[model samples]
Target: MLRTVNVTRYIQPLREGGSLPALAEADDDFKYVLKFRGNGHGPKVLIAELIGGEIARELGLRVPELVFAHLDEAFGRTEGDEEVQDLLKGSQGLNIALHFLSGAITFDPVVTQIDAETASKVVWLDSFISNIDRTVKNTNMLMFNKELWLIDHGSSLSFHHAWMHLEERAKSPFPFVKEHVLLAQASLLKETNEAFKKLLTPEKLQAIVALIPDSWLEWPDTDESPEALREAYSQFLITRLNHSDIFTNQAQDAREALI
Candidate 1:
């Protein structure tokens, strides 16, 4: 389980992506960008963030530290904005907190000379998870300390949205990789796929899925319990791992056009 923190103050909201995430101060004296369950996307986004972001880190990619924040309804009472108050009130309990990268700036591929391998690894990871948010229009990447850090994985792992179609969708290739900001610069798609695919063992996948809070996994429509959903996610990842080549080739083809 990720470290749990108590949110002490409700800072202002950040209207970055579709989700209205907010900056808040926690008990640990650190600020974090909090993704609330009350948002339109709901708890599945949190589940994706946990599994997708952690999987990226375990694969040797850079990611921000995650913390499970405990929110008190009182914070909502203090918020002046009616919209934010509603958001806070709806998310009175647990939320995902991304450790604030205070001075980090949004990554701009135009000025950055990213190495081929690094870009490919990121593109490969995005393709593997079927993330549609890493396009040139919205990279979901930040630069801090002269290094790129991936963020906002709430949109990854979309197969989980419908359990009935998950397996079939798992094997489908991600065409959106062509829009990935790094695809043009990525040169080692096959090499990165071969190297990192081994890291996602069944045990490792299970462990990563287990980190998601049970509350987030329980959907009213799904008959599968949290543990069952976790296992399903693990299997989906394993299956997706086997199907990596198709997407890797797609990335390579797109890279050719871009370069």
Candidate 2:
């Protein structure tokens, strides 16, 4: 079960890349990336990441193992709003420290491209759930244990409301053919669809939806119950799964490539 933890010590920061307040563990017991809320330009960004990361895990995605943590006040101070701080404390500091994938490295989008089959699977998953984070520049995927591990889902779902408008709603916001790596490999969609169907059950989907904070939902006047939200999200998934040709094609392509 996912739970909160008390981080005892401060870890070294990873200087090369990453936009948030992230650090690498010093002790070798478990290499972890500690994401924190600091007094900076984007404190709310980290909070979004925590929620999205947990949601991805619940969806059966190959995300890193995550643990919600509390930073020692002595480490540093966060310049976030009181509401944000309260929300974090209410949700255990809104910090998600993920177990780092050691011996794994991020690849250039062109250098280590996923086969059309895998791309189809990934794109299908993202689209059904309204994930807009996995773009051409910021795929947020990793190669670990001879397989793909997805990371950094902070930019997905509720956080993407700003991009959602009348024009955007008319067409699929996620056009895999133009943006994803395996656009030409459309056949993988079938395999991905099957895998998604097997993993995303009504019960699991409900549980995950229930876990979402009421504060995250955009509709101010919409006082929908958690169960209602679950049902709605589930319907959304079913509708997209049935109608999305990209999902079907990509899953098939991915399955064939693996064979």
Candidate 3:
């Protein structure tokens, strides 16, 4: 079972881009970043964040633990303003209080301290899930305690829905480069594939799919069982794994070049 702690409402606003409301934690003991889900967008994005975080941990990635949080109705309001009640209305679901990775720096693809081998593996993982979040500009990766940590998986597997309508989606295949780090240092690709197969079982998939808030689904009137959703996701994983050889080959090539 995942452990959770009660988070206080007191937080400082982060002056950063994005419509999601963010705040810095008051207590220095653990750096807790609060992100409020946009009511208008429903809770699909938040659900993705939660599920992805858990899956990453299962795959041996250094992902910070996350928990659901209830936002006080007056969470973002200034000190004492009665009229602001409605402004903070309809806020709910999953407060991700992640452990702060101290002295960590974002990996830059252009001027990277990480070797080509490692970079290749990271890219392969991102591609496997079709994650567009960890691009050159926003590679939400951090290095702490001499280890790499992956954060912000909100953007992965998003295209699962659009695959039905989009024609060119299959053209851009997943990349499997030889200079990947996983191939050189560890068989991360093989391990991740195995883990994924184990976790994508019908039972596990149902549990994960059930975690998504009902409000996020497109057709609120339609009754979709968690089991059905899980099966769909399972198929998706199987499809990706079937092409695991591509990533492995890429990692091998990259590793050989470095040696």
Highest lDDT model number: 1
Q: Which ranges of candidate 2 are over 4 A from the true structure?
A: 13-19, 24-29, 37-61, 77-92, 113-116, 158-173, 213-259
Per-residue accuracy of model 2 over 10-59 as CA lDDT, tens digit each: 44545433444345442345556766544232334444555456546755
TM-scores for candidates 1 onward, in order: 0.96, 0.63, 0.66
Residue clash pairs of candidate 1: none
CA deviation > 4 Å runs, candidate 3? 4-6, 15-17, 24-29, 39-41, 79-88, 109-112, 115-121, 160-172, 175-227, 243-259
Greater lDDT among 1 and 3 belongs to 1
Query: Compared with the true structure, what per-residue lDDT tens digits does model 1 show for residues 1-259?
Result: 6899999987888998677898999999999999998888789988888888998898888999989999987877867798888888888788898999999999998878789888988999999988899987898999999999999999998887766777678788898887898887788888898998787787888888888887787687777788888888888888888888878888888888878
Cα misplacement distance, residue 241 of candidate 2 (Å): 5.0
Return the TM-score for candidate 2, rounded to 2 decimals. 0.63
Point out the worst 10-residue segment of candidate 1 by lDDT.
160-169
- Best-to-worst order by lDDT is 1, 2, 3
Instruction: Please give the TM-score that candidate 1 achieves against the real structure.
Output: 0.96
